[model samples]
Target: MAEPTLEPSTEPTLEPSTAPAPEPMPPRPAVAEPTPSTAPEPTPPSTQRKAARRERLQVPHEPVTVHEATAAASVALAGIRERCTSAPKVIAVELDIEDGRGQVARLNFKPAAGFKAASWEKCVRGELESVKYPARAAPSHVVLRLQR
Candidate 1:
């Protein structure tokens, strides 16, 4: 057998490629100034004063609680029972309350019950008008019916 001869290696060596890095961009501004058109214009003194006064006058308020309303109705009903000659009369009383104070706006009595006395309605109205409600932030309407 003949002996084999060794040959030189022809494969290339492995190495990392080198390249230039890109330049970084500049940072953007944090906030931009408001344009003249975007900004609100100043109003005249008189107009501003009027708007302030109107806003002040239009203060918000809350309605009276159910308990307070019931108390007021009870007081009115008791008064009605004492003065009303027509017992077992059904009547509806409507109250218009402003700033926690109430006044009778309407008094409706069932005509079929044969209770046509204006004095009874007037008396009930007087009693309801005197109802002092709890402090309320707004105006309220209350309707109470009297029966039994």
Candidate 2:
């Protein structure tokens, strides 16, 4: 009347009912062997890597106003772009804000052969820094970016 007694079951229960052991695997067949030929292969001439040229954008060489040069790369970017709506492809230019000293500002573009990106960014930045940038800051830089 006071308590109920329960006895534990004595049973060896197995989980993951083990399957029958598989038969021994057969050995793989022999692979074909390669033999060296007596004839020697000829070497090709040396070549240089070249940059890809798509469209030639005609960037006007004019005196851009101080205000217009902040995002200075707009016209050249627009000219270089294949599509109207998308932004042009940009490569980084590590420009020295000061002469020779490496206080760099970020500039992104591709320049023509013999053109220097660092100097160009410096020039663009100098022009803008000399004047107060407009509240609606227009692009002051004028460098070409590769069209996507």
Candidate 3:
């Protein structure tokens, strides 16, 4: 038997590619600057109504008696005393009750130990504002000292 001789193959070897690169993206368009307007925007109707209401409510009118003021405040604030655990022991409130509505003018609190007067101010004001008061000769200016 004759021995067979080994021969190298003649196929081409693979190599890394050198193709042309993709074109760069076009520059983004520039944004236009906002132009300043000569006149301010008009106020909405709802906002205008609210401003009118506030003006009407805050207008100075004839004043009511201290007795009238006290009675109205007592009725309005009774529920708050029962509902609020953080309520002050004593509260001095000044209010203006006009046209079936009440607005808090000032509030002073003698809070219990560890209690804060500032914390309860908003609650008291809200309660006062929610009350309905009969139209009086004028607005009421009364200082009430409520005790627990």
TM-score per candidate: 0.46, 0.19, 0.47
After the best TM-score superposition of candidate 1, give how far the Cα of residue 111 lies from its true spot, in angstroms: 14
**Candidate 2 deviation (Cα RMSD):** 17.9
Better of 2 and 3 by TM-score: 3
Off by over 4 Å in 2: 1-20, 37-148
Model 1 misplaced regions, further than 4 Å: 1-60, 65-67, 109-118
Residue by residue across 1-148, what tens digits does model 2's lDDT show?
7697765445755654355788999999997564467456545433222222224443444434433433543333433343323332543443322211222244463333334545544444333234332222222333222322
Stretches > 4 Å off in candidate 3: 1-62, 109-118
Q: Predicted candidate 1: what Cα RMSD to the true structure?
A: 14.4
Worst 10 residues of 2 by lDDT: 95-104
Distance from true position, residue 111, model 2, in Å? 19
Ranking of all predicted structures according to TM-score, beginning with the best and ending with the worst: 3, 1, 2
Task: Estimate the overall C-alpha local distance difference test score of candidate 2.
Answer: 0.38
In order of lDDT, best first, we have 3, 1, 2
